[model samples]
Target: MSEETTRGRAAVSGVAWRRRWRVPEKYRTKGTARPEGGGRSAGGDAPAPIRQWPLLLVLATTLVGLVVTLADFRIGLLIVGGALLTGAVLRAWLPAVGMLAVRSRFTDVVTYAVLGTAVVLLTLMAEPRPWLEVPFLSDILRFSVD
Candidate 1:
């Protein structure tokens, strides 16, 4: 082919390449680069707003539970269970919790509640007093130990 024909073909191919790989309209331009302020750019979907208070409360409760663990192990387990229960409550009611809100709302709430209740019950039934006993748990522990 002639040099001019080759150059023309290259130009046509460049345009065709760009046309083939064209970005979707929604992601074409992010709002951050624009001088005029606006909400999020991707299809106008607003970012999840940060909720500080709930996050702080969860952190504080967890820290307190950790501190309690230094004194009495069984009571500390109860305190940790209480923290988990608090987290479950927050997950059920709060809209956004930054990092704490991991999984779907229903799953998170149920998981936290169940685990917390189990911890509380197990701690209560442990060792000396044995306020509430579960035959299955004792059997499982005995099997595991042997």
Candidate 2:
């Protein structure tokens, strides 16, 4: 082919190359960037006007449990319901800790566990099932026969 024709073909190919995306050198191996914020980068960074989602989930779950309890619900509802109450309480208190600059995920987990335990204890105490009883196994009786 003549020089002019060759140059034209090359130019066309270069344009086509540009049209196709080329991975930048930096991202050739690794993945996406972490959020640029200091602590707990929001999956969504809109001003959360009300309770955070974890808190809300907890609240919803808890409310469901309460409904079940009133409607003569099941054990799952009670357990999950107690959990939700714990969550609501955590939602209330977590931000307070965060205000002191301890907003790490670990702290969040520990707080949730402790609060959830308390909630469970309170619920058990609040009202217990009539049929639920601690069984004493009489089969293996230990008597001070001496």
Candidate 3:
């Protein structure tokens, strides 16, 4: 490709990348302290500082998994539950333990644990039911303003 076209493609791709990953948006540089009024306020839908989400996500995952696992299944449940707990705890705390780029482990643990728990609960509950719903979409919207 010609130099101009190559530069144009690169610039366009950069925009796509920035939009796809809200954290590294064009206006805000990653790893720098966010401006006081830049992102969504504490009460808004804007992503929380990278500092907060993992622990929160981990705790939620732990609770959800604990509930579903407890609600169903009669065999070796404790062992499985404990393993999920370990993953959730790891997700929640590991970042603080060893500084990292983002708090995604919490999501990973929750994804695995929750999905697994759901399958087990459905399989064994005999009359499967949701322990919780998707949570308040409004609450999430309220959190992402900036």
lDDT of each prediction vs. the true structure?
0.74, 0.52, 0.51
Candidate closer to the true structure by TM-score (higher is better), 1 or 3: 1
Candidate achieving the largest TM-score: 1
lDDT of 3 by residue, 64-143 (tens): 65666666553344445555555555545443422221335555556656865765554454424544334474378569
What global local distance difference test value does model 3 have? 0.51
- Candidate 2's TM-score reads 0.34
In model 2, how large is the Cα lDDT of residue 15? 88
lDDT score at residue 105, model 3, on the 0-100 scale: 54
Worst 10 residues of 1 by lDDT: 34-43
Ranking by TM-score: 1, 2, 3
Which residue runs of candidate 3 sit more than 4 Å off their true CA positions? 1-73, 96-103, 123-146
TM-score on alpha carbons, each prediction = 0.56, 0.34, 0.26
Output the number of the lDDT-best candidate: 1
TM-score of 1: 0.56
Collision count for each candidate, in order: 0, 0, 11
lDDT of 2 at 80: 68
Instruction: List RMSD in Å for every model shown.
Output: 10.6, 18.4, 15.8
